[model samples]
Target: AGDIKAGRAKATQCAACHGIDGMSKLPEAPNLAGQTEEYLVKALNDFRTGERKNEMMTMMAKTLTDADVANLAAYYHSLGKQ
Candidate 1:
């Protein structure tokens, strides 16, 4: 389990593309609201580990700790029912 408050705080960095509420601000960024936690975690981890190949995501994800990943995933997944 992750801390929603902590995730929200950390999500400021993500708000430029992915909105404060997990919606996307730009067309290039997919809306993250209602995504599965498992899927978000996997995608972030893949970006961090170089398994995924988005330049922006790779750079952004590299600094994330495991807890950060979990928390972010939890926060985004909690946004809406899918």
Candidate 2:
């Protein structure tokens, strides 16, 4: 398991879209809490690299380093679906 403290800190930018606990209020946004780490990492990489295209997500993911991806994935996985 990764460090929750580091994950939380890294997730600060994500709160606006994903919510503080990973439950997104936006119908279009997927709830990431409890999602598999593999999925989260892949999705983020896709967005960052332009394989996936969401303006906001691309912008956000673009700024995340590999460690940030791991930490955020850990935090969301810990939340576990809602």
Best by TM-score: 1
C-alpha positional error of residue 2 in candidate 2 after TM-score superposition, expressed in Å: 4.0
Compute the lDDT for candidate 2: 0.87
C-alpha TM-score for every candidate: 0.95, 0.90
Instruction: After superposing candidate 2 on the true structure, give the runs of residues whose Cα lies further than 4 Å from its correct spot.
Output: none
| Model 1: how far residue 40 lies from native, Å | 0.3
TM-score of 2: 0.90
- Error of model 1, residue 50, in angstroms: 0.3
What clash pairs does model 1 have? none
lDDT of 1 by residue, 1-82 (tens): 7777788888999999999889999999999997898999999999998999897999999889999999999889888863
Worst 10 residues of 2 by lDDT: 1-10
